[model samples]
Target: MEQEGEVPHVLIFPFPAQGHVNSMLKLAELLSLSGLRITFLNIHRIHQKLTLHSDILSRFSRFPNFQFRTITDGLTPQNRTLGMFSDLIRRLNSITKPLLTQMLLSGELGPNPTCIILDGLFNFIVDVDAQPKIPVFSFRTISACSFWAYSFVPMLIEDGQLPIKGEEDMDRMIDGVTGMENVLRCRDLPSFCRLKDPSDPALQHGVTQTIQSLKAHSLIFNTFEDLEGPILSCLRRRCPNIYAIGPLHSLLKSRLSGEESSLGSESFNNLWEVDRSCLAETVSQMVNDVMENKRNELMGSVNETAKLAKTSVEEGGSSFRDLERMISDIRFLYRRQREAIH
Candidate 1:
């Protein structure tokens, strides 16, 4: 529990993936802007990569309330770049699970975290016994559409829509997932869903992990209402407490101004070397298509989407309001905890 007049503290734990760290770090920065204490947890390898690739340490250090901590992900340097995510998940559950238990029990990370924003992939953390009973928000790095699609993997398996039969089945329309029945095809499901056997361990593990997302007290996604309203609606039916306050990279910029607003890009957090050999040609062609082509309708669409994105993060917009509500709710959670303790 927080002491009198102490700022609310949030612990942000991201799965050791590029996308997960990028979005969660953005969220951590956003929360830091609200004068909250933020402790960002990173796996040791990813932390080293981020430090090597970016001025992340110097940049974040400017925020007095923000800090980073690293833990071993239970993988040797050799096995760290494991082939499949499911294999990594299995290792993390078996190895890192006890580490998390120790971290929480020690209370040495910081003040008892008023709230915890965990990568949705790590829903297993819910099983850890942390005495203070913190409110955990499952933050998914993917779009609302992807998360919604993932939630229905079990149904897809049961309906015989998965174990996607052959090349012919690639174009097969999928009706197992509600709200996306018409829009989704077999080929559109995530790559892991293309397995030849329904009983594949990897496939089953993915379903189990995605299903476990529901166990979180709330869900946070890096998307805005304008982008995925219908799918967000479907998601809300299952997880009533959700915050779709994102395009976090953009939203953070919209909420800040001047040099203080300077934040790192996705590449800054990337673990692997980026290939820029063909960048010049790619940009040249893209610029030609957008600006020079007489028949290009893409420019108009791009402009329209950009305008919508800007509006969504400005005052009185859906994302801006959602972000405020999310912050307020987290503060409320802290208050409720304090009240219960007293």
Candidate 2:
């Protein structure tokens, strides 16, 4: 039914979490705009949630070439709950490999995917590399600073500074991370990195698995160059193929026509309930006077830095240039595949 020399197809697998899924979806939209056929995959549970929203489903149905697919997460309909579902995620990660492989080899889904772009969190997917011909790229949905922090886990372990063992040492601070100037207290790092019990295997297992997966492929981080110059420079030296294409929402808004881009206006990645207790207490009259009197200087400096970073990612900025280059690369790959098949 179709002719030869069609666009190269891409399969995108976002880590089942909300942030990862939202970031990857933005990239998928950019790829689709470049004339590539995209098959966006999600865990079955997440897919069901999206489908339930009638407005979202209606918008999704309009993208004919950009299709949605799902693989079982090994989760039952009743298992969904509040807070971090670590056990369920671990089980889902383990089961994804075989299901993904089956989908790739089925042939029923059209030509095998030209490439598989996976979320950094789902490092287990990298293990399914039996089909080596299909290139895989890791999409890390975090700041370069955050990724750089993660990369130090092994060294921290070697130094006995991490994998916090017991209640007695919960307040320890870690020193000598490359980009961060201030000494980081244990609480400042991601919650998973602060596990106190040595018997708890998930924290260590996740760190090890993510590090091993990074070795398998090139990485694309959702951070712009100017915003993360120090960390991005360090990462580029360590991993040559790393691409810093981010603040992706801003980039997409600039490119797409007003109406087309608005589809993602309300899209957000926070699945957890908001905890505003700290803010509420801080704003109360008693604390407000004490805090405001102490130092307005520190607060102003932070705001200034944020504003500077925001301006640098606008049109003609570093992120815009990298995005252009990325689009060019995708177009070139599609052309080459078309030539080969013809």
Best by TM-score: 1
- Model 1: residues with Cα > 4 Å off, grouped in runs: 1-5, 82-84, 128-132, 258-267, 272-282, 286-295
Model 1, residue 81: distance off in Å is 2.5
State the lDDT of candidate 1 residue by residue for 237-294, as single tens digits.
Answer: 9999988887788888866654444453332556666677868888888978767765
The residue-level lDDT of candidate 2 at 231 comes to 83
Q: Give the TM-score of candidate 1.
A: 0.90
Tell me each candidate's TM-score.
0.90, 0.80
The most accurate candidate by lDDT is: 1
TM-score (C-alpha, index-matched) for candidate 2: 0.80
